[model samples]
Target chain A: GAGVSQTPSNKVTEKGKYVELRCDPISGHTALYWYRQSLGQGPEFLIYFQGTGAADDSGLPNDRFFAVRPEGSVSTLKIQRTERGDSAVYLCASSFGLGADTQYFGPGTRLTVL
Target chain B: TQLLEQSPQFLSIQEGENLTVYCNSSSVFSSLQWYRQEPGEGPVLLVTVVTGGEVKKLKRLTFQFGDARKDSSLHITAAQPGDTGLYLCAGALRSNDYKLSFGAGTTVTVRA
Candidate 1:
């Protein structure tokens, strides 16, 4: 079985630009999550979707960050007016259900905002 | 807000050595997960401890959850070079099990 995967393994954009990162979760999985990881730091939660709706977005740093998981399988993390501070590795993961379920991750998309 | 703090942010040891990493938090969680991540890759789940004072083992790795559910520890027995990587602890709050708060992580370097 194939694992979770992310597109645009690497992305470089100038400040104030917009970028979208994509994620493809495992087949039949109903939950998807997005996280941002800075250098030498663990991944920070961003947003999570259960089915087609976002169950939680509290972890999103600000209004500039938004994510959508339409169709209940694929998701996208969108950053508007990106800042230099926004540069980091964007990770996507999925689980079979909810709490206590093992989360499988993707290779991640490294976004560099210069 | 629940915050998980991992101890010994960095560790280096020779192969065959034994090591333990700790994760502590003031807030209690319904479940805790341990993950190992290699450079340029996303984290891979090692184990998940849900019941308080429960212990789970994965080959040479051992995981323990505190009785209060506010802490956990990962211990490696006869560590090997393959065990080297960044170890992270993430906790799921009881109220919001879908949201996971991760620790800063501990980088382990096991030399052959």
Candidate 2:
């Protein structure tokens, strides 16, 4: 009955540093997704994983962004050489499996690249 | 790239008033969803409509999907102060079931 959750609710790092955001999906959820939300904007898709494999990463803004769901139930979003422009709220969501299923969200991790 | 545009990006109204928010896109989607998010929290799914021209209701909230599957609308009746928050529309493209394209969102503030 637990909902999705993200760790390090807030992170602040230097522009040239690296940061990793973590997500814990609902129990038994086979699909997970990562998204980024800028202030006053809706969340933008980043990547999706189905059973530990990234099914789609097209939404990733660039090579600096990467995500992995190694065990299928948990995921990590990694940002390399972060830029000040990369500052935003990183959101994670998960679903039971496919198509029409509702993707529940996590509280999100706010990353500030100083 | 699919884009969902939400109109009247900001709305403020008194309690007990009725309001409607719209989401439109040029690209057709297989399904569309509405979510409500408050400050310091993640979005919570309100409803999902998969069939063209489909309509679903959640208590005081009503949602409609366009016949062409390219748009949707959310209407709230007799809204209360508790109804205030950000309304977001997300669409799942025909090409990918796992990915969602979200609108910029409409921020609603219902005053008592």
**Which candidate wins on lDDT?**
1
* Residues A14-87 of candidate 1: C-alpha lDDT, one tens digit per residue: 99999999999999999998999999788988888889999889889999999988799999999999999999
- For each candidate in the order shown, give its overall lDDT on alpha carbons: 0.92, 0.91
lDDT of 2 by residue, A64-106 (tens): 9989877778899999999999999999999998755789999
**Model 1 CA deviation exceeding 4 Å by range:** none
Docking class of 2: medium
How would the docking of model 1 be graded? medium
Q: How big is the positional error of residue B78 in model 1, measured in Å on the Cα after superposition? A: 1.0
lDDT of 2 by residue, B53-94 (tens): 999999999999999999999999999999999999999887
TM-score of 2: 0.95
Candidate 1 at residue A68, lDDT? Answer: 88
Instruction: Please give the range of 10 consecutive residues that has the lowest summed lDDT in model 2 chain B.
Output: B92-101
